[model samples]
Target: MAKKELKKVFNLNSYEWWRNHRRVVTFGLFLSIFAFYLGNPFHKEGKVKDTCAKLNSSFQITGDEAMKKLNLKEIKNYNNRELANYYCERYLGIK
Candidate 1:
């Protein structure tokens, strides 16, 4: 392709570039938050340890337990009562 043609084909200004890269930006945000939670000293230590331990064990749990282990309750998007209950009923098991 010619330079002008390529430039026309892929016009990338700040707004356009950011719009096209929104998913990457959102993923980066999620990663940053997850990393922060992983290292947060005031909390997450015991919860993470317990969750890891539960995962390592050959056990099943109800959805509530799954949510607890995954820290889903703390997730803003999926933290509503209905969703939490749904996760408990549909995705969790006990063993």
Candidate 2:
């Protein structure tokens, strides 16, 4: 009996259960969206810029200077500027 009840609860094609728990589902979805926005997951460039600004103010090193100082391994055929930006983001915990 317990196994049968568990199977019913876990049924994927059960619209009846969804309808009965519409409020809970809606609240969960809203909460998820709110958390996602609150986390600012898409503003990576902004974070990098902020970090670089702080680095510049503290060390007097401009973006160009920092890029020129990067000694990355040329294993992949990636662009130098892009690789430098990625390194800066990772080094400063912006990513």
23-44 per-residue lDDT for model 2 (tens digits): 9999999999998897785575
In terms of lDDT, model 1 sits at 0.60
Provide the global lDDT of candidate 2 against the true structure.
Answer: 0.66
Candidate 1 C-alpha lDDT tens digits along 1-95? 58777777777335878889999999999999998887786465556455545544565444456556666754556634445455444444522
Clashing pairs in 2: none
Model 2: lDDT of residue 50: 59
Model 1 misplaced stretches (Cα beyond 4 Å): 1-13, 42-95
How far out, in Å, is residue 86 in model 1?
A: 45
Query: Which lDDT value does model 1 have at 38?
Result: 76
